[model samples]
Target chain A: MAALLETLTEDQRDALKELMNIAMGQAADRLARLIDTLVILSVPSIRLATECAPDLSDCPIFSAPSAYITRQSFLGALRGEVLVCFEQDGADELASLMGFDENLNTDEHDELMLDVTNILSSACIKGLAEQLELPASFGAPSILATNSTLFDKVGDVINRDQTLILEICFKVESHSFTCDLLVCVARESLPSVIEAINRMLEDL
Target chain B: MAPLSDLLRAVIDELNMGVMIVDPELRLELWNRFMAMHSCRTEEDVQGRVLFDVFPDLPEKWFRQKVRSVLELQTLAFTSWVQRPHVFDFAGSRPITGKQSKMYQDTTFFPILEHGNVTHVGILIADATERAVQHQIMHDLNQRLSQEKVEQQHLIEKLEEAQNQLLQSEKMAAIGQLAAGVAHEINNPIGYVYSNIGSLERSAQDLLDMVRAWREAVEASGAPELVEKLDDLAKKYDFDFIQEDLSDLIAESREGAERVKRIVQDLKDFSHVDKAEWQLADLHKGLDSTLNVVWNEVKYKAEVIKEYGNLPEVECIASQLNQVFMNLIVNAAHAIEERGTITIRTGCKGDEVFVSVSDTGCGIPEQNLTKLFEPFFTTKPVGKGTGLGLSLSYSIVQRHQGRIEVESEVGRGTTFTVWLPIRQPEKQVDE
Candidate 1:
């Protein structure tokens, strides 16, 4: 697992984390403004995608059995999929904040999930693209599963070897909504991403 | 000569989708022909106006935030038809399905960047009503298919129940035929053996008396030697004890044969082969006969108690009613593990006669109460029950235009009460 992370130089790893921190901050800010609540974001962590497989007991999102997962794909200079996992308890608060009734049917829950995923994924991807000067387009966000195994739902999509994963966590201060965002970049896309980051570094 | 900018404007005007641009202050900078057709306003009227003012129904707060995010992050933003149905209320062009009364739209906001600073936010809207209608149709079809699947499952369950009831009745009919044949075959030999035992006892008494008289005559003829010899022979053969024991042996044998005859008779009565047609009969008599038939099964498990009521002669097929009594009594006996009482009570309620069989044993659970009469539903261990006893009993009562009711409690007891009218209705008989 360490060998996979060793593929990136110390400077590249620090740059990727810094870029993710800025992107996730923008996502948190947008969600806060939309819901009129304060949002807190954690420092993003960069690791090998295979190291994040759910079989690891320490994996945060997978360890929580009751998590709602949403997924979207991005295409541009760097490409892979983005996964947002929301705790089940947090989903209720999020739904209520969106002006939905306390008892949400399946369709209402699905709509709420898609709406949140769209807000966060778009903001995060857009933030990254703007910083890297890379034009990226995001596919429509969709709910993958509710109250199900996160690994089983996303295992096939993220199964490629030597993929890099960036994990970010966020919380709504006044509400109970907390979630984890995982951005997985294809191994082939890493070199292009590194070049873009170095170009921005020289410009800075 | 026309400038290249004028030709670009001409091409934008010919496009099908709506186009608009908003500046940093959220004022509309440009509107295109598609927007003019849908919004009922042209570029001359809406340009330089606030976008919300032009379309009052637009979600002002949400749209402002979207445009702000585009300008602030310099990143593209999107909203699907599902998130918000339409930003502009364009009337429906195809109203056949009436699913969409207004045009469904997918919108995107992109920042127009110049010199690394956002200058304007350009908005594009595409009609999505056709796709929305197709999705609605598919969702409706899926819901209907699931409903049909549920109904089909219920129908299959009902068919299975009917088949089980048919099978149980067929099994009972075959058993009844076999019982009747065996009873008839056993009756003949038992009849003659019972008669011969009675006659043998009387004939033995007469022969013993004749032998004693002849011995007295020989002794009185003064043949002393001959008399002594005869006395020795009688003592050696034990003639006196044989004369005394022979009569008792014949009497006991006669009694045993009588019991065998009675058991065969009870079997015949239970099968009702001799009388199938409906007739007026005493319920108590039928109850006693059923008790005799099932005594061996009940004797060791539980004691039987009878509570008789002044019941009228019910018009029913006696043999079928006997069968019902046998099933209930046997079920009650099976319910009692040991040292419990099976109470068989009968009484009259207006024009109806009721029989109740109750057991002081483990009672049924509340969840299983409703399923008690369903075919193939049993709590007994495998092979201990066929799970068709109660179901068959239920159908038999229904056939006679009667009803059976039960009350039970866990670890306390269970009671099955059957009610039948004294007179069968003519319509019921025809059916």
Candidate 2:
């Protein structure tokens, strides 16, 4: 079967990018307020693929702590994964500054990560939804590990050829952050995306 | 007319809170008037509707989870927070609703049953607002207590850090109290190395001069006088012996260097077991290094006599025990102010290894021996002690599941004996 995307016309792609830019900017602003940090979200690289493993090389999680993050997933018309990852070193450095011990194991490390993630991801996800004119709520968060094989569960449906990955960086204060957003569909959902974004940007 | 159940239900409804009754499948059986007023939904509207369908706007995960557990796991679900709380919509009820001073207490979900199967779940909301506020206050108080404990621990660690610095300076202070002995210890090797270097340099210089002289003699007299002398000189100096001796000297120097390295390393390990915890530590190793730390204190006042026997690696916090050893050794030295011997004997007996440090100094008064292990009850003068040394030792030994025994006679001095179990408690090993 062909990808759900029938080659998007350049104009449609441009429109989607521009709309995403606006949505992400709004999300970044919301995150900045929550984490009390300056946030810079890159215009996410949107690709067309599904159900096959996506190349995770350029993933910022590799350069960051395997812990300390907040992620929210929305599963419906357009199923994808959204993440807010913070560097554990940054966390340790922050803890050091706060005069906390640096010997936190995976559990404490994750707990701190979740506390921040809860605030950051919730704010950003809600802001994006509000812009999209969707009155949806977020799910209770489950802390995740970036350095392990567990991350693949974020998009279990993602595969080599059909799944799409849309990742953005959400910075907190001076610390840089990244969110990996994976969108998967058996066929293209460009029209739904275009429609959703159009409504969101206009409403905002 | 069914006035009885209605009357009883009406009384229950008049009580504070919104209560709802749902069947096994979450079919809304009853929604009170309060729920109707608060939720803006009549009982007839939600009477047969599933909980999730009615509260679709609610957090799906939190709601679906409680619903799933109420059915599958057959357990009630509950949540509470101090501020900015989440409320479950009922016909006319809420959780912890009142003045800020009368915040809601704990809220709970109950699984109601009928006919031995869970047929109904009663979602009851109580105005625990008062209990909630009290609990928050208590929680805040507990946090303050724990924060104080952490502050105390931080101070203790800081004090320990300062103590470690003092001990390091003491080790390096070279107070020259026993400068002669230390000088001898260092000089014995330097002496040989210096002499060997001198002889080697002299021999090499002679050889060079002889070679030059031989070359000049051959050039001047066409004879080999200097050459013969050179050969004769080599034999007299036992060139073969010097050759063999030179190799041995180098080997000896290397060995001495290695010994010095081990001594320095042991000093480090003894001075501060950085982690201050347990490992595959040899009690004998700890004892030896501790002796080095207090060597200066023990050297002149009392001779350290070690009676080492076969001992296994006792699982224990090594640094803590090192502190114990220092305390006992220094005490023993102080006891023998009139110049006596401090004997340290270590051996394994069954599952216990006993280390006894006996001194010929003034022994403890018969009754005072009991107070020796109590923190801050030191026999040493005020400035000389923290009083925590023996208490700390006792606790460290106790943590290792070990015990300390003291034997004393006024004239014969005192012997502090420590018995450590071969297998330490797992929790102790963790520390």
In candidate 2, which residue ranges exceed 4 Å CA deviation? Answer: A1-204, B1-259, B272-275
- lDDT for each residue of candidate 1 in B24-68, tens digit (9 for 90 to 100): 877888777888988888888987899878888775655776677
Chain B superposition TM-score per model: 0.70, 0.45
Q: Give the number of the best model, judged by DockQ.
A: 1
- Residue A176 lDDT in model 2? 37
A-chain TM-score of every model? 0.83, 0.63
Per-model TM-score on C-alpha atoms = 0.76, 0.33
Which tens-of-lDDT digit does each residue in A1-204 have in candidate 2? 353255655665666667557767776665454334576766556656441234443344333334444455544454444555554452443332222346866544554444344444444444444444544333434445555432453433344444444555554445433444322322343346656755644555
Highest lDDT scorer: 1
